[model samples]
Target: MDKSNFRFDDKVVLVTGSAGGIGKTIATAFGKAGARVAICDINRVAAETCLKELRESGIEAMYFAVDLSKKGEPQRMVSDVVDAFGKLDILINNARAGERLELLEDTEENWDITMSVGLKASYFATQKAIPIMDSQGGGNIVNISSVSAHVISSGSAAYHVSKSGLSQLTKYLAVHAGPKNIRVNSVSPGLIVQDEHRNRFKSSDNVNYRTRAEQCHPLKRVGYSQEVADAALFLCSKAASFITGQEIIVDGGLIIQDQWALLSNKTHTTDNI
Candidate 1:
């Protein structure tokens, strides 16, 4: 494959919640593609560690440890990225907050946290980035959503609602941002297993959970952060210049199955949820 098609030289990228997991992977991918990256997350230690890793890999990167849940933080982070990189060309809204409670059991605090980080922060950050992107001609945005936005899962009521809102927000922003030459899209990952999950699956105790997850998808395997990163990278690349206001589902065909098949597959266990 001609790798040059995805080259992002001279571009500046800011990835929220890029301390670890899918966010970190996406940030690293963009950096490797020759873009200066700003790694933003609430976790100071993890953000610093991610920055160190990127530097070690010879990728230009900076770290910002700020809580997106707070008012003005999202806008401030965008400003900081612009100050550091001169201009921002790519924005990936990957930060997320969730509570594992059912709708009735969910609290106001939990709902606020979920919305603040998952949806509100992404919305405001994009709002701040639009003008900067417009001034520079154009830019790209990829919001990291989840399959939960489409499928109902037990518990995690706030998380589901936040993701659904995010997917819709992507469409809404794409329509308005399109006039400014900015492209907005989303990637919805399903059953992506990060470091902690890999470790858990290593133990004999959680083997059933892993097996059930694999069976839930047509690919017979759970996804990885890298897979989701690939989708995000593609959407941010010139390859997707004409694609906007759409969601690319990165699930292993998990969403295509009927509700009855999913329930029969024993994939709806609280553990998987």
Candidate 2:
């Protein structure tokens, strides 16, 4: 592949929830790849830090602090980015919520918050960005989905459902936007460790928890934020001009293996030894 094909020079990219974790990585990657980056996050301090980092790296970047769960904030965010950059070429809906409640004990408030951030924000952001993109002759929209969309976990009911909706939303947007040359897609990631996870395992004994968790995956290691960022970049680049309405899963092959197969492999290894 030509390295120049991945460049985003002079292009404007807006990434939501980009203060830290996967969102931060995606925003930074775009900046480094020559795109004018717009970083949006609910946390002012973290957003400032990310913005500073991007600028110091000689990347054109700006920061916006907005609560995406609000009714008009998504549109407002898109407007702000366009106001700053003069044009929007790519939109990455990477923010998410609703990880604290279990299905049986879930509240309406929790569900609303989850759906608002994880799903609705993406919808309205794309709604607002489409015209701008169309005017610019076309653009890319990448929704950061989750493996939860396909595999169900015990506690995260709303989170899973919201992601499922996001995947479907990606397809719907693709169908509607294709005629206008606006491509819509998603990247679904699994078990990528971030700052919060690192903080939780800072203690000496708990530090090995990540290693233990990595063993469960076929790759024998967890994924990094950069991996997901790379996938997003590819989907948005001209390299994927023909691709739309699809999802690329970055799971280290964890979701493909069956419990029976894993157990059988372990049993066979023990017997062979």
Candidate 3:
């Protein structure tokens, strides 16, 4: 099956924002399946922790502390990966910046930080990795965009714009890299129950925001990092070889449903990927 083909055996992957949530899950999956992964993040502690977990499971992993929002950080990180593994077969750009429901009031400082980390980082990171991939004759790049890229609400304006830019970046890379046999795609997850989101409501009396968000989704629930991870594995794997410049929506199918349907627990689940 396509799943099996996506096996990362002997492949070298570099995952950014891999400290927790979907990033960590994706890294673990690759590690479990046998891949040399360079786990990167702004927080070295978290990155090391993730690496330790992977090492405990016997996955060949490395950790690096890099601030993705910095201008040249992407290029530098790519260099680190190549130096560590001598080859980079996959690049997963999953680092994001946002605070839900705080877009309109967002400061310029916050906007720059969000956009740089979420969008620009992806661009330069992929740019740096492309040459390496070309030298190897081919490779894969899977970007972690979000449904927010398309369906925007009154929250995290920069986050939304950044993700939208990311989708376009994915398309551009796909078209440009096709000639070199490298495939580029993106995975857009819906409101998933990740640690960051959970942490947001830690002090709230009603700490069930995830549940509520999930309920609002057409699928009757939010998604897991693992689900999005699975989607990334698919796009990066040979299973989606013929697919490029395409984004796989990993949400609970929320984009299509109307507001009433979403609030009422009605869902449409006939999507066949």
Q: Rate the local accuracy (lDDT) of all candidates.
A: 0.90, 0.90, 0.85
User: Once model 2 is optimally superposed onto the true structure by TM-score, how far is the C-alpha of residue 216 displaced, in angstroms?
Assistant: 1.2
The TM-score that candidate 2 achieves is 0.93
Question: TM-scores across all candidates?
Answer: 0.93, 0.93, 0.89
Of candidate 1, the 10-residue stretch with the lowest lDDT total is: 261-270
Ranking by TM-score: 2, 1, 3
Model 3 per-residue lDDT at 249: 95
lDDT of 1 by residue, 106-131 (tens): 89899899989999999999999999
Give lDDT tens digits, candidate 3, residues 86-149: 9999999999765654845778888888899999999999999998999999999999998989
- CA deviation > 4 Å runs, candidate 3: 2-4, 98-104, 195-211, 260-273
List residue ranges in candidate 1 displaced over 4 A: 261-273
Residue 2 CA displacement from its true place in model 2, Å: 1.1
Q: In candidate 1, residue 127 scores what lDDT?
A: 99
Question: Which parts of model 2 are misplaced by more than 4 Å?
Answer: 195-204, 263-273
lDDT tens digits, residue span 109-139, model 2: 8889899999999999999999999999999
Output the lDDT of residue 56, model 2. 91
lDDT score at residue 161, model 3, on the 0-100 scale: 88
Worst 10 residues of 2 by lDDT: 264-273
